[model samples]
Target: MQNKNHELHVICVNLLATLWDYNRVGKDAEDGDIEEIISMASKSDLADQEKQVQENIHSQITNFCTFMDQILLPESKSHETTSQKHSTAPRPSGLSLAIGRNAPPDTKFEIPETKPLTFAESCQRIKDLMGYTLELKPSQIPHEQAGQGLFVDGEADVGSVIALYPGVIYSPAYYRYIPGYPRVDSQNPYLITRYDGTVINGQPWGTGGETREPWAHSNVYRPNPSEPPSETGSDRVWKMLSKPLEGSRLGFNGEVLERRNPLALGHFANHPAMVMEPNVMVCPYDFPLNEKGMRAYIPNVVFGGVEEVKMKRFGSFWFKSRGESNDGQMTGPVMKSLALVATRLICNEEVYLNYRLSNSKRRPSWYTPVDEDEDRRRWS
Candidate 1:
């Protein structure tokens, strides 16, 4: 009975987390208006249309709640004479999990001390190593009268601090890996690079994206700051290049599986400056989720940093694209939401794991799907 209860709790948490992830991306303020307008367009009467849509949405919610109630109920029956059957359980729909908020903050905020490095030195180091600039965003630089113009107290190395938080301090590294000839290899380059982020041979690997495989000779170690530059480097070069780079021409090739319009109506009503931009790169391959049929396509937190950009893109009066490719042909929306979702999901998982480890819980169940084994079995 206890084991079944524990399973129920686990399943509920996983389902809730999955739904939350979808709502974060799919549910926009504009959805209500869109639904209303669509209903009005379809029906002659405004009140009747509104009521119909409301009823439809309500039915969907009620069905979900009923499913949850059934799943969470214990299966075992008590034989005691005085025992009574379980009463109807009131199911919670779309309840937010605020469990970790009350936990006391961890005190292990002690960052390591290193040799002093100036801003210029840091910029030079990144340029020399990765052939790119490390210009700090305005927010990252220390302001006058703010802690004596230092980013933090007792921080001697500016370079190290910036590197420690590159995503926050500077724009993240964005490179365009042009799909190579014979198409499939170039399009699916990322698949070769990312890891599943599982530990093997006592080493950690597999989180998906840019960490999967290696260059033929240098496949042993993932690229890191300490590693030397590859002589036979990938054609996926830095965005900032000296010459007219080979992969500069933007390409769009992929299929759109799903889409959600942004909420704000007047976002791009008369904005003439908005143009349909080409994709940064073209992949000749489909995302893994397409093959696996996973509804939990990508996690939200992975690409949370780009939340502002994504929101603006969706909210603005413009048509965003989703795409897929086959037979070396790219089709569908010019841009892929899956890529964005993938990035966010990956980042979110990393953040969750890091936070859990910092909080003294070595294993954060958030990243590990509770029903993963069951899912595999069912699929198989």
Candidate 2:
């Protein structure tokens, strides 16, 4: 139940984060101002009536989580999720190159002598905390290219945070520097975008994790020099754009983060089939960097590095399935990442998420729109 409430708080955090941007349409904002515009609606500065509105939003999210719990609790008992046989052995930890193989010049963040948390250890902690475990193996999605999939190895109740999407986070300001800019989706399909335009590339934090050492994230997605160049308008725009400098002045060496969170394989979950309803939904989570106790579990690193930005201004609503700016384009102190939350009781079965691929782009043959209206709203 504690885990459920934490998940509920995250959902509301996102819904309210966009409240500040709901109004006040104007010209583009400067670096600092751009970050502020997406922040949480200020409570201290609000008028009495506005304060009441803020309070009202809090109540609604709480009530919604409670309502869903009431409805899903009974259904959980009748149907168990055993569609395919799971690999009973613990999955392998994500591969990691030996420490110091490619050490950066900036020695600010040191290489610790102690080994970081292991995949099996992280999985044990999650099960102890949430009463469920997860698995990853060949997916049985009936497609020729089902690749890999995330599975709930134990019973998971509704509103539980099932998996976390890990890797370096790119804020709106840093879009130009993404491994493949104008065509950010060019080579990798693990990228997910927040409504505020923050993008997280999950390709770096693949499968599960083995270490908390500074895993180089942004370094993994560099454009392949050998690939044939294309004449597409997207390619031309990117090639013509002046490249912005990377790295952080705020003391961060750049996109190296702890890739040791075992549940960070949220990227492995596949889009649901045409006949299936998604069992899990994407929820935006703002991991507070200062919280030492829970810090290790939150595995993400800021890209360019951001200046001071208020944390409250950039949280989510309780219902979200979905951040800010800077001079060189960096994220706020809060590392924003996506997490998959179970919408229904799940047993030993594959987790399905609505990919919500944009209609503006060409989609795969197996792809079907989960909600046409949602795709329009997102890409438009």
Candidate 3:
């Protein structure tokens, strides 16, 4: 009976964490909301509920919660006391479906540092935390390109999710505020590049105003001027080059970049040399548009027989375009995370990414243009 109770407790904790991870429950979930979830889990029998709940949903929720508890929560707790003292007191709940107040003062979203791990170990750790199976490995490039790069250990079809670029996500404002210029600029003082090469930086800012010094390891994409233009788009290149460097262009918002960590393997992916085709692309993870919609996605949280769950889990598991709508407004929900996805069939060898596009004048040559149908097929 004691063991059973413990199992139930773990299950309940996981369910709650999954809800939070998928944004079904806000990070600043009220004690009452958590109690309600606990009550529901405790009163219900897994055997009885198993028939109604989808197996994938159950597994995903359990894995997500476990990752949070084992990895994120410990780091959060370290600063919890200080944050709690500085945070505003929790407000009363009115039984409405609104999001709760701001997360606890100490609810810093910083990715905790881990001991240095080898490329293989880093990949395994990422897989463990994210519940995704990855087969890529870090290998050295030969000759002039003598540097570490990620290679596919097995065959992967086009549009498959290759890997995730794990690092601290920073908003444009926060990135700019980081003390000192980017490593590239510091090394070559004459050349300074902005994030994403646009007139305005579009990366999302980190919460709580926690800042770190900018270093070479920071994940920034800057174009190399010495590289020749792609043969396919010579005309377009000429047109772009002829135009003045200064002009207003569409810039992305909720855009984010991962600050590479020395211990992360994803950071080793090298930029494409010259105009070679790339196998991987970086994409943003989407978040719900509103609190009500977010809450509706939580599993098993029915209200008066109205089931509101939409997705099995929350993540950038799907590809969404950052394009503008007909009215020139940004479409889709605000993005929160970034992912590295396969653009073409990747074989057992080193993978390359076209990290060009420091300026928005011209699109990078290696970009695998995906239509709505392609996007659907990739995620489906």
Q: Count the backbone clashes (under 3 Å) in each candidate.
A: 26, 17, 5
Candidate 2 C-alpha lDDT tens digits along 41-117: 44333344234333433233233223322222245421321111012212121111112223344544433233344
* lDDT of candidate 3 over 151-258, digit per residue (tens): 665555543445434332333212221223222333321121212211112121211111111111222322334445454464354334323311312111111112
Checking candidate 3 for backbone clashes, the offending pairs are 83-106, 171-204, 171-205, 172-203, 197-358
TM-score of 2: 0.60
Better of 1 and 2 by lDDT: 2
lDDT of each: 0.21, 0.54, 0.34
- For candidate 1, which ten residues in a row score worst on lDDT? 161-170
True-structure lDDT of candidate 3: 0.34
TM-score comparison, 1 vs 3, better candidate: 3
Please provide, for model 1 over 1-380, each residue's C-alpha lDDT reduced to its tens digit, 9 standing for 90 to 100. Answer: 22443443343233323333343445353666545543444444444433433343233323322322222223341121111211321211001100112212221221112224433443344334332322212222123311111111111111111111100000111121211211323322122211111111101111112111110111221123343444332322331231232322211111111011010010111101112111111111121221111111111111101211111112211121233323546332111111111112111011110101112234323223323454343223
lDDT of 2 at 48: 43
Ranking, lDDT, top scorer first: 2, 3, 1
TM-score of each: 0.17, 0.60, 0.34
Instruction: Write down the RMSD of all candidates, one decimal each.
Output: 27.2, 15.3, 18.4
Worst 10 residues of 2 by lDDT: 313-322
